[model samples]
Target: MAEPSNSGGSIVSGVAGRYASALFELAQETGAIDAVAADLSTFEALLAESEDLRRLVGSPVFSAEEQMSAITAILAAAKIGGVAANFIKLVASKRRLFLLPAMIRGYRALVAQAKGIVSARVSVAEAPSEALLAEIRTAIAQAAGAEIDLEVKVDPALIGGLVVRVGSRMIDASLRTKLNSIRLAMKEVR
Candidate 1:
């Protein structure tokens, strides 16, 4: 990934950040950051896998009370901790349920920064060896001057090589891009 601009402070500092900061502060006060993070992870996974859940949260037709009840039930079903369960209720009450995913992402970014870690997304045609993963993580950590948490994804369309993304910066070194470049060069040569 391309380097993040130095001017960008604290990876999470927007509307999402405001909500996440509030949640993070509450989690810290209750000594439940870990629990809340886990709950958010569960919610994130749910959102990723379920369009119905995502639409429900984003729906404006649901009254605040209705949303709160629904969310509370969902959390209970998922066995989320008390702190996170209560926080979900708070978001529902405020009609901010739609912001949950963004808030979760923001909170994660905050937590990572607080722990001196940077999150990186690595995409390749296939999974790399453990040693290669370690080397990539080390290189990213060195470049970012922080501990690295790498998230790997496989994209067969990449053909070969890797694409690394860290926040807004992206390093595109995929064979697909190389082939496109070569194709353009050949056309120019003709």
Candidate 2:
């Protein structure tokens, strides 16, 4: 896969982006882009499912050795090998594990761009059903006129409805925002 250009505000340009770009380049050269992405997704899921792993990844109190040992064991148990595993282990050893989430995001953005897919973030009040998800995907895909990689986040604070963000454009249709708008309009009338 070709390297996505690192333009201004690009996902492949910061500290995390640098790591992600390096990993992406390596993956491309080795023809392991998909495998690395899968492994990274598995690790991200594990991070989301466990507070201990989150703490391990985010806390700076842990020594590099401690972090490396714990992460290595976790990766081994999770069967995440190859470039993904090595890249993560390197991050732990360098005491930069806290940036793992951003790195993963950067990597995903790179992969999406390379595959000619648009990345969209959808935030909803609750977890949407599979049918709802499909509908949203369809709607966005139609609007974008391209394949979309949807990342759904359940944010109860939204109360209802959903907010969709594609690249620099964001559509805020959440109940919370709607109510806020109404409140502002009423105040203006008074």
Candidate 3:
């Protein structure tokens, strides 16, 4: 049998990694990796957009049954089923819902590695237009010598410019950082 794909073994670990790896292998074996990924992306987007959902997942005050009920309704409403839905329900049953985000991230890493894609995160002062996002993705893919899975974040604190992180390398070109550097330089001139 072919070796099961791994999330680099080092990129993700602990409870989240184990769960993610198991799900990834199952999805791969069933030829449903893409479908599972799409479901997970939907779940992740929902989790990001709803404060109540965040609390339900992250808070320990909810009992296992409560979480299971809530998550089941959520999955049904979101039309997320198959292996992804089952895996999430299992997590809820085991009272591990708080680790769902990490598990999704780990799953993403595994998928990216399998597809020869590099995951990159870009933080900017404002949301980039689709054209800008495509340009940035192309540039990063060229620099990394692989297709890029770009995750964009908007942080008004950046003031201007953007910061890109691809693996261990980071390029911080934010106006905030530049001004801080200049301020430190002037302090040294005293």
Candidate 4:
């Protein structure tokens, strides 16, 4: 697997953090981080596509044995072998499948950080065009002075404009927020 860029940092802590850290460390030691990350991305896409699979992982109704068997079969059929395959099986066997999503997120975060890529979330009134997204990426990378991974979410209620958040800093450029500010100013004027 190709290694990501030069993002320097250690993993996080807490339940999800601990699990992510362990998995990341193992993948790193085995030089399989990229492979594991790809597998996890595939798994995440599967979870998003299949409601029954989502329920199976997130709901407490299923027995651990059932989840393990089902997930094992799914992994095998998906041809998702390697550190990722084993790590997921372990999580299911431990009845921690409910935490899988968070673990995946945590893993992605670590991978991003390792790649020296800052993550930015942008919420827009509609799906952005590729040109717009590329523009945003260039702007953010320039501002951050680092490689960036952008996640765009669509919220029609925003009316117009987009909100950009990077780490603890946020730019509330959404029309909804601007309208709210105008309303607040009007109240003050009254």
How do all models score by TM-score? 0.81, 0.82, 0.84, 0.88
The C-alpha local distance difference test score for the whole of candidate 1 amounts to: 0.83
Q: Candidate 4: TM-score?
A: 0.88
Q: Which regions in candidate 4 have their CA more than 4 angstroms from the true location?
A: 1-11
Question: Between 3 and 4, whose TM-score is larger?
Answer: 4
- Per-prediction CA RMSD (Å): 4.5, 2.7, 2.7, 3.8
Question: Could you tell me which residue pairs clash in candidate 2?
Answer: none
Higher-TM-score candidate among 1 and 2?
Answer: 2
State the lDDT of candidate 1 residue by residue for 1-190, as single tens digits: 2212226655566676788887787787788888889988997787788887888899999899888877887888888867777877888898989888888888887677667677899999998999999998998888888888899999999999999998678999999999999999999999
Query: lDDT, candidate 4, residue 56?
Result: 96
Each model's C-alpha lDDT? 0.83, 0.93, 0.93, 0.89
> 1-190 in candidate 3: lDDT tens per residue?
3433544345667899989888989999999999999999999999999999999999999999999999999999999999999999999999999999999999998888878988899999999999999999999999999988888999999999999999889999999999999999999999
Of candidates 4 and 1, the better by lDDT: 4
Candidate 4 lDDT (Cα, 0 to 1)? 0.89
Q: How do the residues 1-190 of candidate 4 rate in per-residue lDDT, one tens digit apiece? A: 3332233434455687779878887998999989999999999999999999999999999999999999999999889998999999999989999999999988898788777888899999999999999999999899989998888999999999999998889998999999999999999999
Residue 38 miss distance in model 1 (angstroms): 1.1
Q: List, residue by residue over 12-96, the lDDT tens digit for candidate 2.
A: 7779998999989999999999999999999999999999999999998999999999999999999999999999999998889
Candidate 2 local Cα displacement, residue 161, angstroms: 3.6
By lDDT, the better pick of 2 and 4 is 2
